[model samples]
Target: MLSIDYQQLLAPIQQFLQCETPVTWLDVAQQPAQLPILLTDHLICELKAAQSAMYLIRRYAVDEQSGEALLQWLKPYEDFTYRQQGDWRALADIKLKKSMIPKADSGFGQELIDKMVLLIKEELHHFYQVLEVMQQYKVPYDKISSSRYAKGLLRHVSTFEPNALVDKLICGAYIEARSCERFAKLAPLLPADIGAFYLSLLRSEARHYQDYLQLAEQIAGDAISERVAFFGKVEAELINAADTDFKFHSGQPLAFSAAVGA
Candidate 1:
């Protein structure tokens, strides 16, 4: 089994997230008192984002028609969390599969499948945990605008066949890596309870990033370092640049004082 040098990557990951954490988020994160609330929101975003990738795989990258099924699988959780149309007890009963994609003779397929399945499972579990925390803290759920981070990086994808797929997978790698990095950066700044939770996520999150990278390599069958660097630059731009949205992955603060000021 292939393994990632998680400890080795920690420093770089930390640097990426902390580099441009926008002065805007500092105040919110510094409020150790509100760490629980902020972290709860962060966790939900992570799960939903991961679920999106799962659907992408089940839809475009995998069996092609499994996309609708993937949506159905996530519908309950989405309705409960985002739409508020379902109950928590209903979510507890939801049993999404660990691996919707199967293994193949190439070894590449199975490796990607297994790793991503673990990621989706962990992400969904994290979502549930966030809801639990929110319920305990009496925090109300609200819809936040989509972050520019993912879209910015994704825009660089080549409009071709396997090249597009390869680029998308590479973009996935950066997203996962950046998320792991952000969690590490924010952990120490958070309250003890939330900090512990963030630290706990470091292990699996780091592995998830590596998993995406490996999948990119397996599919491309060549040196993806240039491609990786290409997306890294794009991703860094999205993070280092200014933005109006306030999200877990949003860039510079847009002065939307309404959300923070409120």
Candidate 2:
């Protein structure tokens, strides 16, 4: 069981989320057979999170050449995750040098670069950690279709420039907050070691959500409560409604009733 208080850990997340994760999802999550899929999705989610942050920085904060360098920095991990071309060990010595990107002229640009770079670093580290845990459990990595949860929220983003950026940040905040909330919920239910690992991730995940929210506010320079509320409702719908697929962030499983009937 987790040593920390879940309510305290999840307070901010709960406030941000419009709804809680359904019990049906939790029931499916507790099944032993679900471990492989759960962990695999988790590993992928970490890498994807890093990739998203990198893209945000590269597109808005860095110059063209620097953007290419950022791609090069991420190539190996992407290759490994997508094609299984290299082992996770190859990622150990890789370092993101400061010279890869030029200094930002605007305060907003500098802040985005700084925060997103740190986020990428931490996410990749967490990806490595998830891979290690999968190795320990003999869980093989296989590509799986992404859950609808993210896409559902992303579909609501405005196509306009600053609005698009603000919306993406808001979406990021929701994703991170949901991740933290789920980690707190699942930690105590898992085995001791795994539970401890999940608990350990709570602080970083919470901070990540906060970082995204702060960036959104900074970029908007005005009250973003309306947009935030919009995404919250979308996120809550994705969580509360029935989902055909089971993934790390998927909603209530449609298979639940079938399993019960069987």
Candidate 3:
């Protein structure tokens, strides 16, 4: 593995977001007792990230055939994550074909397909990596509810055309950036191999956020600084607010604090 000056890598990411991962959340996240839920949520987060990318491509960029192909490509992993019905060992060989047909004459279609295909590939690979780590840690697979974090950001999306797509892309940027930030914060606090794996993800995660932002700008065809800042505030508020649920992307854990007090 290559050496990283994490401080150097994370500086811009830190500057982009409105706030940091709360120390209180980190305190609970690193506990041994919290590992099960954390790993489970982390695993699902990877899957959801891939699904989000796939959905974006299918809805806005690809033809119907390509869209169906995308869904089929993702099905096995979805089965494993959602139904626990497949072998994790076999996922490494799963690959998205290179010849996806783009929607006819759409300006952003090809670009969206290019960027999102790569994101979907990386995210699915990460889904497998997390599952491998879970197996090593003896964390059994179990379904868990998503945290309010994503919904909180998405609920604000404009219910109009290109605005809706642009908003979704902006929200994707925040989600990736926040994931990268939390991974950096929690990596050193975890056990060695897992810490290294999380650290290994920094570059791609950072790039994923940038990719989403660039796509957002391209789709909107104007300066999105105002909208980006708008989401920065929404994302920060979500991160800062207290929550009973504790997932990988959860806000501060009120439930954990209450347990400790009791």
Q: For model 3, how does the per-residue alpha-carbon lDDT over 135-241 read when each residue is reduced to its tens digit?
A: 99999998888899999999999999899999999999999999999988888899989888999999999999999999999989999999899999999999999
Going through the candidates in the order shown, the clash numbers are 1, 0, 0
**lDDT (CA) for every model shown?**
0.67, 0.87, 0.90
lDDT-wise, the better of 1 and 2 is 2
TM-scores of the candidates in the order shown: 0.81, 0.95, 0.96
Report lDDT (Cα) of residue 219, candidate 1: 80
Worst 10 residues of 2 by lDDT: 98-107
1 versus 3: better TM-score goes to: 3
Off by over 4 Å in 2: 1-6, 100-105
Q: lDDT tens digits, residues 1-262, model 2?
A: 4444756767788899998888788888877788999999999899889999988987778888878878887888999999888889778778786554544564588788888888988988899899889989899888888999888998999999899999999999999999998988888777778878998899899989999999999999999999999999899989988887989999889776469558
